[model samples]
Target: MAEAYPLKFQENHKSHWARTLRNLGLAYHQIGDNTQALDYAKHALDIYARLAQDKPKRFEPDWAMSLNDYANLLSDKGDNTQALDYCKQALNIRERLAQDKSEDFESDWAMSLNNYANRLSDNGDSTQVLACAKQSLDIYARLAQDKPKRFEPDWAISLSNYAIRLSDNGDSTQALTCAKQALDIRERLAQNQPERFEPGWAMSLSNYANALSENGDNAQAIDFAKQALDIYARLAQDKPERFEPGWAASLNNYATYLSDNGDSTQALVYAKKALDIYARLAESNPKKRTADAERSQLNVAMLAWLITGAELVVSAEAAPDSALDYDRRPNRFYRHVLLAWAANDPAHAANALENAWQAWGAMSKAQQKNWENIFLLACGFAAARAALPPAFGTWQVQLTQFKTRRKAGLPQWMEEIARRKGFALV
Candidate 1:
């Protein structure tokens, strides 16, 4: 193909050459070789740009398509800023083309709007995200009504995207509805054509799981997450490069639902699996996977801490009146502790320490010992200085005495977690 591309260029078949380049880019992207995909997409876009400038009417659509392809490649590489710029260019061209020939280009225009909305999401513009997503969904819904077979899949996808934005905006009820609708369509499609639609069905299941989880339906969330994980596991076994990311994501979501359902031990196992996959992915594409790896690592650490009964005690002590309010207290306490240690937020740390100190006075000897062990496990000494309250002098002496009496370092698991979390043990 490389040898033939030069021949096509020499013969003045530049359009053909560019189209082949774009196709090659798509191929590489499908296989998850984003580096190669981006390189090919860039070349294709350059050729298309030159051709479109010379003959706008004849080549502009192709050029816009190339821009969209390039944008997708850039997005996959974690270059969101550049991706948004290119996506806007594609949307502008497609919008104008659709205005002149709606019958021929309206679908393309709607697709570009969806892509633009996705780019806006990466930029954190919630207002514009919902606006663009709504516009795309409206267009897709109309198109699907007119031609169900031709446009139903796109409509379903638009519904899923719109659902996410709705959920993010705190419209959980509507988001759940949209997610369920999308899943219904995909389910029917998969039933009719499993080979072509099963992947999409699995994706819809994952999205539905998220919506359910957001609505506090942990049991249903876990069920859907498991189904999605099962499908992704099979797909990844057959095509690891193309499907492992999705599989890892499903594992991460499944772990969260399990933890929420009071299965921290099982959650830890799945979280570790997700972290392993993301870490391996980061080795090859740090820009794209590093954040995911870090997030999964944090999830693994949180689940491990929960399994150790630290979060339970922290929740109970942090809110004695509402000790059973496991969700809010544990997360709030954990956040304050991390902020104290990582960001040196004196106010939050002081508050957390004061609460812990008060709780310590009320505990039995066995509970006191457990609390001491948990304090060490949480690396409380690392934040003790930053979190010193009015009684810090006495507390510091007490901590020092405890440390000396123990005369032992952090447990191996705690040490590894500290290393991953970038925490220094004194």
Candidate 2:
């Protein structure tokens, strides 16, 4: 259909072709055809971008919308670095449009800001996350005040994002308030339109529960988290393809809270459940789901280690007999195990570190040059430092060289991983 439309629509009708391309891209995305989705989205974006270069007033908004759509697809495909770049393009266009006509472009600008905030948050870049979320929330608040029925859902979404950023920034008290306000708005909306608003209400419940947990209200956190889990569970049961990810995410969140509250047994149960769901999803859609699967696997390993007082030994049957096993372990089990043994089981931790080092040494030069691979190696090194700090004296020097060689800013998630393991990324 997309090919037929392009053949029918000549170059003079580029706008029509671009719009069709964008629509097709969206349709493909809805059906989980990410490869075709990206192809169509990029084609639309290219046409719009070229048109906007000559007639900014006529095509800039269209181009920005295409950029946003492309970013969403890239994000879903687990290419967040590219996603961030596309989101910035959309936000820049929207910002300019909003400045010229605030009433007409403010909503779009706010939407872009919210999306930018989300991508940054996912990448562990907390520096500008709060500011972008607040800017989006402010716009939504004003719009909702003027037309509650039309803009209330957008307002609630912005509030929820703002709450997440606030919680990440250590302002959990205000985060809880923001989350609760979003929950109230979603609850009201869902009461009238369950099909439209129930998912949102469930999301808000999870966000609010997270804030509650951060604020040291474990009981309330567990209660709200359970409510979110119940909603997601029901939704997933009815539509596994769409809602399973949400259910898995809720399980992970609930498990973390339970673990923090000294319920290791239940927490392990929930974490394993989340991992099982992620594994199934990854098997069905490897390109889009593998990252989530790996993270959930790590979470399960962490939970098991914690349940054993951080002294879980490598199973004799499962122990690595080859470099292939070690290579797989760095990003999955070994990294988590290294942290668990940082102070508790130094002998095993040293063994893990030695295996990780051997795996790193086995990588080719080209593989080491890739940012994604480098980030994973950096994380492995950080975990090794936590388990054996003195062994990292030379690594600090090498890290400086690595930073100097890279032109782009360091990935914040690597630092986050290191910080979680009680080490700094030198």
Among all candidates shown, the one with the greatest lDDT:
2
Pairs of residues at least 3 apart in sequence or in different chains that clash in candidate 2: none
Estimate, for each residue in 100-120, the C-alpha lDDT of model 1 and write its tens digit: 999889999999999998877
The sequence of per-residue lDDT tens digits that candidate 2 reaches over residues 1-426 is: 354556324544998989999999998877667889999999999999998897788889999999999998887665667989999999999999999999889999999999999778656678787899999999999999999999999999999989878766657678889999999999999999998999999999998887776666777889999999999999999999889999999999898778756676798899899999989998987655665677677667656765564554333223444433212333533343344344355565566555555544544322233323234444555455564344444655556554443323233334434545556665
Which pairs in model 1 have colliding backbones?
A: none
lDDT of 2 at 415: 48
Positional deviation of residue 194's Cα in model 2 after best superposition, in angstroms: 1.0
Estimated TM-score per prediction?
A: 0.68, 0.72
